[model samples]
Target chain A: MKHLIRKDFLKEGYVFATRAAEIARAAGGHTRPARLASNENPYPPSPKAVKAAADVLPPHANRYPDETNKEFIDALKKRHGDYRFVASVGMDGIIDTVIRTLIADGDQVAVATPTYSYYGLAVQAQGGTTVSVPRKADFSVDPEAFCRDAAGGTKLAFLCTPNNPTGGTTETPETIAAICENYEGILFLDCAYIEFDGTDYRPLMKRYRNLIIGRTMSKAYSLAGLRVGYAFVPEWYEPIYQRAATPPFTLNMVSQAAATAALRDTVHVKKIVSVVQEWRQRFIDECPYPVVPGGANFVMVDVAPP
Target chain B: MSPPRKADDVVTELAQKGGVIVRSCASFPPGLPDHYIRVSIGEPWENEAFIAAITDIYQP
Candidate 1:
C-alpha cells in the first residue's frame, strides 16, 4: 500500500476530502461546528444499541468474541431468508473480502463512475483494473451499455442504490436481469441506504445466481460508529468469502449485539427517518439550488455560486 | 463567501455598500437558476440562523 503513496503526498496533507473539509471548516469558521456531510445521520444511536454496546464496555471486556457471529447472522437470516451471511470488520472490510475472494489477479471490476471512490481504490490495490460505466445524464444506470463491455476477466459489477454524489438509483429490474444474464460476474449490489430507497431487490435473489447484496448498520440503522456490515452471498460464493475472510470472534460480538438491537428498535429508527424525510422536504422546498432527488437519509447537492 | 487564503486570491477590493455574496448554481445539474447555493437541510434552529444570515445579507 505504501507503494501507492507518493513522495509529494507528505507535502500534500491527507487528501481523503481534507481539502473540501478544510474549505468548509474555514467558511463555517468554528472549531466544533455542526456538519451534515459524509451521509451520516445527525441523530444519535438508539437506546437499545447504546445499551448493547454499554454491556460490553467494562466487565465483559476481558473476553474474546465468537468468530462466526451466529446470533446476529441468525437475526439477519430470519429477515433475509436462507443466505450465507459473513461478518467482516465493517463495510469496508466486507468490500475488501468480496473483491479478494471473487477477483483473481487482473480480473476486471466495473462500478458506476462518480459513485463511491472506495470500489475503484480497493480494486486497483489488488491489481484489478476498474472499468467505470458512467450513468445517464440523470444518473440512472444504463445496464445495457454498462455490461456490454463486461469482457476480459470482468468478475464483479458493483451497484450502489441511491448512489453517492448523484443520489440517484437504478430501479429497473429488467436491466439488472440483463446484466446478470449476460455477464458471468457477481453483481455486488451495495444497498447501504436501503431504508430510504423507493423499492427493494430482495425478492430478485431467487432469479439471479450471481447477485450478492451488502447491507450496513450505518446510515439508516444509525450504527455508524459500531462498524457492522453483512454481505449475503449466493451459496456458491459463500465458501469463497469464508476462505478469504478472517473471522475475528470478538469483533463479531460487538457488532452482533449492536446490530441485533438496531434491528429490534425499528420504531425509533423510523422516527429518525421521519425527521430526515421532513428535513428533505424542507430542503427541497427552500433550496436555493437545484437539489438532486434522493430517497435516502442524506441529499447530494452541488453549491455553484454566481 | 470565503475570504482569500493563499497569496493568489488577494482581496484588493473592499466590500462596497451594495455588495452581495451571490452563489451561482449554473454549474449544478438540472433545475436551478444561476445564483443557486446548496445548503444542508438542517435542524429548525440551524435553519433559522441560516435564514436570518441570508436575509440580513441580501435584504439589509
Candidate 2:
C-alpha cells in the first residue's frame, strides 16, 4: 500500500465543545437543548443587520462574491485607520491565513498554554512546531517565559487575551510590547473577545509593526453564523499576505452586507455587551462554586467533583 | 454509602436521569482532571435545573 497522507494529520484529533443536542439525542431524551457549549452571543443580530442580509440574499446569490471585498475592507479601514486589513470567513480562517502567510515547514510558533487550542492546532496543520509556554497559575502569560521560547527558528507567536475557557485575566500591553521587542518573529494577538475585555490594542499596533491584531464579529456582535472576521496587518505585510493568500471572495455578499450593517449599529452591540457583562458578574456572584473572574461574555465556573 | 463518583458518571447520570446536559472537562488537554465539568451560564430556570440535578446526584 502506498504511504500517502501526512502521518501527523492522522495522529491529530478534532476535540471541540460537544453540542448538548448531540448528547441529548444519544441519551434519547426529549428535552429542548439549551446551547451553551460554544461561546456564542446569546442574542440574535440587530434588526438592521437582519434587514441588510435579507436585502442582499436574493439578487446576489447567483454571482461570485466580490473578490476584492472593497466595501467591507473600506469600512474596516475607517474603523482601524491607516492599518491594512483582511476580512475573511471567520476568525479561525483569519488565523489560518496568517499561519499560511508566515510559517514554512519546521518554523516555530510560540503559544501560551490553556489559551485557544486552535492556534497551536493550526500551526501544526501547516507543518510548524508549536512551542507551548505555560501561563501563570492564574492563566496570565509570563512574558519572559514566552519570549524565552521565542528564541531561534520561532517565526510566529500567538497571545489570546482574556483567553477562552479561562475567561479571566489578560496580557498587559507592556507585556505584549515586551514579547514583540524580544522575539524577532511575528506576533499574532487574537482579540476575538476584545469587546468583552475592553482593551484597545490599536495603539500598541502603531508601536510594533510585527504585531497583527485579529478580531471577529462572532462574539460580541451576535454574528457568528455570518462568519465575518477581519485582521489589522502591518502595511508592509499586507501585499505579502495578499500574495501568499487565496483570492479575496472568501466572504459571500450577504455576509459582507450584514457585517457592514452590524459595524454601523454600535448601539446594538453596546446593549448586548452591557447585558452580557452584567450577567457574567451576576453569575459569578450567585454561583456556589468558585468561578474565575471573567472579563469576557462567559464566566468559567468550576464544578465540584462528584 | 457509595464512594464519590467521577465527572463522567455525573455527566452521564445528569443526562440520562435528569434530562440535563453539561460538559465534561476531562478531554480539555494538556491534561485537566476528571473532577471538573464546565456549565455554560444560561437563563435562570435552566441554571436552576442544572443545580437541581447536581444537588440530587451529590446529595444522594
Candidate 3:
C-alpha cells in the first residue's frame, strides 16, 4: 500500500499549528484558550459581510457556485485595478496550483529559510526540490544570496512579504528588483500580511513580468474561516494560470458573497489592521525576552536556554 | 531570574498551565533557533493574558 503512494507522501505531511480544541484538551479541558499561535485575525468579519453570506445561503443552497467566480473577481478588480486575477479556495490552494503548473518532477523551487513552511511542503508534494537560501541574522533576505542559489535552473522562487512567524517585511523593493533582474525564474511574492505592514508592492508587478503577488481575505479582512485567496498575476501568465487553476467553484457561493462584501467594507479591515499593529508593538515593547522587530501581526521571541 | 527555557518547553508550559497557545519556531527550518517562539498578536485581553502567563512562567 505504501509503494502505491508518492514517495514524498510517505514521509511526514505538513504539520499544522495546534488547534483550539487541542489547546483546550492540553489545558486540562479549559475551553477558552488564548489562541496566539496561528496568526489569525483576532476580530470577526464585518456585519455586512456576514449578512451578505447569510443573504445568499438559503437561495443558493441547492445551486453550484458560479464557475467563473465573476462577482468575486469583479470586486477584486474594483479594489485592485483591472489586473488579471486568480481566486482560489485559499492561498494554499493557489500555491498548489502554481506548483502544479510550473514544477515538473525534479525541478527546483528556490525559497528563503525561516519563512512560510508551506512553500517547501507544496514544492515537495509536486516532487520538486526546494533550494533554500538562509536569510540573514536579522531575518532580512539577501538578494545576491537568493539569486545565486536560484541561479541554476530553478523553476520558481517564493518570498513572503511581512513573512509569517517572523512578522516583518524581509525583502525591500530594491531587493525584489534585484532578485527579479538577476533570477530568471518566476517570483511568487506572498503578500498575505501586507495590509498590516501597509506597504504596496503591487507596483513591482508592472516592472517584473515574472512576479505574482498573492493576497488573502483571511487576516485583515477577518475571513479566515471563509477561505478566500486571490492573486494578481502578470498579464502574460494569465492564460497559463487559467489553465493551471483549480476547478471552478473552488469558492462556494456563500464564500464568494462574503468575500466580495468584505472587500468593499474597508473600514472593518482598517480597524483590524490598526488594532493588530498596536498590539504587535505593545507585545514587542513589553516582552522581557529579546523580540524580533517585525511588521506583521506576530513577533518571534528568543527563549533559548541560558 | 530563572534560566531561559527551550522554545518547546515554554510552549507546552504556556498551553498546559497558562491555557495560552503560541507557535514553537522549531518547525521553521534551516535557520530558526530552538529557543525561538512565534506569538501572534491577539485581542487586548488575550495579548495581556499571554504576556502575564509567559512572564509568570519565565520568572518563576
Candidate 4:
C-alpha cells in the first residue's frame, strides 16, 4: 500500500521545529524563549490593521470571499501601479500558482542558487525539474551565465532580489536588461524584500513584458500570520493564468480586509522599514565578523573558522 | 581550543544543554562549513543573553 504513494512525496520528510514554547516548558516553565530563526518581523501588525480584520470577523463568516480581491488589488494598484494582479494566501501560494501555470510535467525551470528552498520544493511537487545556476564565489549571480544556461528548454527563470539567506541583491536593472535581452522565458522575479532596499522596479515592468513580480504582506507589512500576497503579472500572462483555472476565492474575507487596511497605513510601514534599516546598519558596524552587504532587513555574516 | 572532529556536534550540544538556538548553516543548500552558524540578530538584551550563553559554553 505504501508503494502506491508518489515517490517524491515519500522523499520529503517533515522536519520538526525546535519550538521555543516547548523548550521553555521542558526547562520547567522558567521563561519563554525567543524564536528568531524565522525571518519574520519582530513587530506585530498595526492596531488599525488588527481592528480592520476584527471588524470583518463578525457577520462575514457566512459569506464567500471576494475572489477577485478587487479592493486589495485596487489598493496595490493605486500604490504600485495598474498591473494585472492576483492575490493568494502567501508568496508560497503565489509561487505554486505561477509554477503550475507555466510549468508542465518534466519541464525545466532555471533558478540561481543558493536562493530560497521553496522554489525547488514547489518545482519538484509539480513534477518539473530545477536547473540551478550556482552563484559566484562572492555570492553574486552571473546574469550572462544564467542567460546562456536558460537557453536550453527552460520554461521559466526565477530570480530573487535581495536574495534570502545571503542578503545580496542578485539582479540589478542593467543585469535584468541583459537577461531579458538574452533569455527567452518567463521571468518570475520574487521581490519579497523590495521595500527594505527601497528601490522600485515597477518602471522596468513596463519595458519587460516577460516579467512577473511577486510581493508579499508577510515581511514589511507585518502580516505574516495573515498569509496574504499578490503578484503583478504582465497583461499577456493574465489570459494564460485565467485559463489555468486557479482556485477561486484564494484569499478569504478577513485577510483581504486586513491586507487592504495594512496597505492604507503607509506610515506604519515606513516606520518599520526605517527601524529595520537602522538596526541593519548597527549590526554591520558593531558585529565582530565580516558581514555581507545586506540590502534586506536581515544580515548574513561570515562566521567561518577563525 | 576546539576539537578536531565535526564542529556541528558542539553546536548541537550547546542547543541541547545551554538552550541557545542558532541555525547550523549545514541546513541550507551548499551546506556551509561545519563551523558556520547562522545567528538571527535580535533585540539588545535578547542578543546579550545569546552571547552570554555562547560565551559560557565555549570560553569556559
Instruction: Choose the strongest candidate by TM-score.
Output: 3
Model 3, residue pairs in steric clash: none
Top DockQ prediction, candidate number: 3
Ten-residue stretch with the least lDDT total in model 1 chain B: B7-16
lDDT of 1 by residue, A1-306 (tens): 777874333332211422334544445534433343356666777888889877866776677776777778887878677767777666777898888876666778988665666776677666677776777767777777777765556789887876654665545667677777887788888877777664677766778889987888888787878888887777777877878885434355667788878877879888877877787776556544356767776554433331
The C-alpha lDDT values of all candidates are 0.63, 0.76, 0.85, 0.74
TM-score of each: 0.80, 0.90, 0.96, 0.89
- Higher-ranked by lDDT: 2 or 4: 2
Candidate 3, superposed: residue stretches over 4 Å from native: A19-24, B1-4
lDDT per residue as tens, model 2, A192-306: 9888778877887788889999999998888999998889888888888777666556888999899888888889999888877776776666655567786776666555532
After superposing candidate 2 on the true structure, give the runs of residues whose Cα lies further than 4 Å from its correct spot. Answer: A28-30, B1-21, B31-34, B39-60
Q: What is the TM-score of chain B in candidate 2?
A: 0.81
- Cα lDDT of model 3 by residue, B1-60, tens digit: 666678888888888887888888888887877888899888887899889887777653
* Count of steric clashes across candidates, in order: 8, 0, 0, 0
Number of the predicted model whose lDDT against the real structure is largest: 3
Query: Candidate 1, DockQ to 2 decimals?
Result: 0.12
Ranking by DockQ: 3, 2, 4, 1
Q: Give Cα distance to truth, residue A151, candidate 2, Å.
A: 2.3
Model 1 Cα lDDT, one tens digit per residue, B1-60: 642122111100001111211122232223322332333334555444443444344311
Alpha-carbon deviation at B13 in model 3, angstroms: 1.2
Instruction: Tell how far residue B55 is off in model 1, in angstroms.
Output: 8.4
